[model samples]
Target chain A: MDPDTAIGGGRDRFPSTEHSLLEAAAGGLAPEALERVAALYWKPVYRFIRLKFHKDNEDAKDLTQGFFSSALERDFFARFDPSKASFRTYLRMAVERFAWNAHAAGKCRKRGGDVAFEPVGEDAALTESPEEAFDREWRRQLFRLALRDLRKLCESAGREVEWRVLEAYDLAEDARPSYAAVGEQLGIPETSVTNYLARARRTLRKLVQDRMRGVTSGERELREEMRRVWK
Target chain B: MEVNSDPADLSDSVVDHLRQVAGLPDLSGTRYELEGEIGRGGMGVVYQARDRQLERRVALKVVEAALAGEAALIARLEHPAIVPIYEAGTLPDGRAFYAMKRVTGVRLDRYAGAGRPVAERLRVIRRVGEALAFAHSRGAIHRDLKPQNVMVGEFGEVYVMDWGVEAVGGTPGFRAPEARLDQRSDIYALGALLQFVLPAPAPAALSAIARKAMSAEAGCRYGDVEEMLADIGRFEDGLAVTAWREPPMHRVARFWSRNALLLWLLTAYAAVKLGIFFWPYR
Candidate 1:
């Protein structure tokens, strides 16, 4: 068997875990999968926030914990169906939403009074010299993670139609084939392919929102996360 | 080919080896032939190596996978201002490794001492500014736009290396003093470079502009890189008084010599007239 075909290689796994978690969540084992993936992913997500925002330890930790707690309560993992998007992408979108809330809250607090939070240490080890390209790449990576999860989730759910339309139009590196060609391949009209892609995008957006439910608490938080993740 | 569900194949061995190598315990891999150390920074050490398959010289920079992540950030980037990242993947030990074209050039700080004349130095400075502007347009802010980060090749090609501390809109290095590290950060650095490269007076004016751009109060500074570039133009044209003013050291020497020459000429004329009067008395 081609081992490379698996999700993440041995010792470092995600794809299988995500699948099992999703299935478990769907089949009443969701509680267990939810806890496991959350436990595994929380710190990584927190670290991302810490590094990207250079937030203090407390704030980073709080956001990290809050994101997972919200996810559990909101059924983020339980709602996973490859029919919508990939889990990795789902997590990133969740984190982005979390960041926006934290940022907006921080701004609001600053307006009211002195926000007393220590800065991340000056000695924080930097891998690259500070350059704008570095930051853009970081943002792009987050985008890619969400996109990857979306692609994988759809493929897994046997939603080959929606998945293929998105894959050909949005994800694939090459220029998209004409709608007619795509239609011929998918056994749908060229117009249908375009229409399908549009619908698929909306589905992807909803999937992201669904995932956010597990990561955020209320309607306000959900809306904020949705905006952040979608953006 | 049959698909394997085993996780082993999903992760690359190269990724693991690199992770271990970067983490400091040591590296023992035959797949990657580490030739020699090229450079070292906060992130990782760069090695010049041979790609056994392609048989081409490539620079390998090993970083911590956990810190670096699944996709190599450098690999996805392309810019004239940035060193091109060619490929990235994880080693066996989960170390993240990135490869790029080997650049042969002197750091910007060393460029000035390379015996290049003033015009060449200014050109290098301008080129660096242009590169910074390009990256800024992509919403990338180079917080550390110092001389050392800029490199100049033998052919006068300039490249900006190290985007490690970039602030997107506002990243860590974008201190309140610089306010927004965007293109203005590069502009400040360019202004500093102009001070060093351009003739004396030009530096002062350029420095003033730089100081304004880098002002802690963001409102008082040039809004963007375009504005900064326009200021550089003003300096180059000698319109910037602080930058183009004659050095005080030259002023004193020139003033003394001119005054002495004038006095000597006037004395000579007076002596000739007196001599004419004396000749009449005789």
Candidate 2:
């Protein structure tokens, strides 16, 4: 089916020169339209979540559904801007922020902190049979596959200077060590830790953006994705 | 040293290096007789070739002009369902090359469409599903899941052909309606495959299920591969040989979209109000 007539048709199209789609999305297109637009980009968001969260498919699906629901919330839409960055950048930034918030809250919950969990959104109205649904989940594992490939690529290039730091801390936030501690672990001075992290962060960010290239468009969008990771 | 990365660059220098390495012949006695190209796509080109050392035929796939970085990623994988990469090095032309056990079979499409018996076709589809399920369980997602890429050997071995197109399951048209294409998207595509292979007597209920499974919207599909697999098991166990077109709930969701809105609004109001009152005190 052509995506145009569905809610996505009205939401946004690619190579978004200006942020007209962002504007429409901000203004509240119909729920169907939101779904249409979300459909176009959900894969990237979900992949990022899978890589960041270390959660399996069931959890990934819940988080992903939650992400879209969060995006549609009144406050989220109200705060969005087109001129600031591309949609891909905006979406990735949103995911990073959301994950940080969610992780922080989960930690709070573990501490006997009574943080209320909002019922963000309803379940997706999926129609495929059990067999078909199985196929989709299998396909979803591509992110891990891609990550594995990326790890090997880096190793072969002998670009080990900072990738170790990235691999260690990027997957799980809790395991992150202070710069002094990292320097001790790697047997480098504390000052060199900062340099390692800076270089590592840049390389990690570049690796992700390069893989993501061609799947989207334009140099600006790629830069936007780079900006998004730290967001 | 850090990989020299210019932000605008997609050129995979790592792959380029590997291609250079391949030129040196890591396999002391093996000379690869490059033959005519059998297939080509965005990632690499597959050529029918002779592995002189093995004294047998094999396929050598040289990395495309792009995707030079994939040299490292593809080289590590070892699975029955995947096309195995035996060695990774560079070709004389400064392109990365990998050799795998060349496959001989018909594309799934040939055996999947009309004129085939329903039972046999469904069996083939099930094998495809199992192979994909196996891969996912091992933490791999074949983002490019389509009939053309699926190879069905003479003995019915189903090999899912590509991973070069893979990323974190976000690219559309590859996985289920949910984000980060999971096992469920493979199931949905398999469902689509069933539609391609089976006759008209197949149920509309199945199609609705397939449509939802393959939904462009990630949030509208099944949660994972296992759930879908369970449903398929129930389906096959019952094997509604008669092929019923419409199930009752399918009718309800269609006619009820108008009412679906009303119900959603009533629920949303309650949720938001309650959410506001119970909002986290931060």
Candidate 3:
């Protein structure tokens, strides 16, 4: 594949591991990998349908789920050539193509065929282009998965206080409590609140990076992706 | 809320996830309000925000929590080429964020990419050199000095950014081949930037200067940004650059090259006058 096809520069030196995911799926060594791919991309596909294709939420959800099930059954990933494009771009193109074919066949609302993907709702207004919406949704999905993992980590480690502190301060848009306020609310000292939040942010950042690495093509692309995610 | 398996709840959670990933801080209580993201780097993301108390817009760089200390240190740097930090504080989440003067212009790479005149590009690079010189004088090294890290304002102002990653490490392809990074490493990066902005087959004198700055051996590069700036100044003034040892023939060629238009005009004038003078003789 033309390394430059990936996002950032220095692709020649640092190849991304995303290709391996495709390879594993194509080789049939791991059905779980394909399932993971479906889980990661389903929301972005659904969002693309709703925003770009102008489908309603219910129709978008059905089309998204149906597309994934059909693609998996047909071994769609095996046809992907990383040399031709980055996995993100390739997957986006595949989703668009699948949606187009389904629409042509008048199967946009045919539900219960297979692949019962989770229902993801449309949140923000469609202010961006379809491509922009797809990219943004992709990033949101990555963050959501990373956050879920972070929550698991916190629960296992008995760091509910830290998790709550982060949720209040980082996640809450209304009444974002200060460190002192969070401390008072949680019955901890302000200094401890600061330390816990710091810990949580660090852990979250690492988890985000780890999740990004799974999809990105190389170190440079990973850094570029992370920068975009933060931006 | 009871155990809810409602699809609407799932959708609400998705919206909540979007809010967190948006990285928009609730600055309603703070003096600054988030406007939008202007730029981003590995260390931090910069948002264009309005300082409500000050009634002005500023660029707020909110770094990852781990780099908070570095952000604070960068706020202390004062230079014309460096983006001036107006204030430093933490988000409620404890991430280190600082407000700086919001510059309205493109990155140096983009600015240079527009095919601006060579002189203008050099001027921008010189401003960056001035910033680096001041920084090194203050015992700080800008380890990352690529074109992306430099911003050029609409009014011809230049500002260096992302000091949060300063002296931390260098960007790939710009990193010096040295175990210990210091002032010379920045000089090397300046050389890379010069190569990036300068036209292909750059003037012999300027290419030599870039070569010296990007020398493999750290000691071989310019000792400081000022010295490199001086060489650039000399090159701009049509004088022999310190970086290049021009032979007499090459110096004459360079002189001709610099004054090619004037020389062409002079040659035309002389030919016209000579033709008139020889008219009667003929």
Alpha-carbon lDDT, every model: 0.55, 0.52, 0.71
Best-fitting candidate, measured by TM-score? 3
Top-DockQ candidate index:
3
TM-score of each: 0.40, 0.40, 0.53
**Candidate 3 ranges beyond 4 A from true positions:** A1-231, B1-28, B113-115, B166-169, B255-282
Ranking of all candidate structures by their TM-score, best first: 3, 2, 1
TM-score of chain A of each: 0.42, 0.39, 0.75
Candidate 1 residue-wise lDDT, A49-82, digit = tens? 6666666677767776777667767767655544
Superposed on all Cα atoms, model 1 deviates from the true structure by an RMSD in Å of 17.2
Tell me the DockQ of each model, to 2 decimals.
0.03, 0.01, 0.05
Better of 1 and 3 by lDDT: 3
Interface RMSD of 3: 8.2
Q: In candidate 2 chain B, what residue range of length 10 has the lowest lDDT sum?
A: B1-10
Alpha carbon deviation, residue B63, candidate 3 (Å):
1.6
User: What is the DockQ score of candidate 1, to 2 decimals?
Assistant: 0.03
Docking class of 3: incorrect
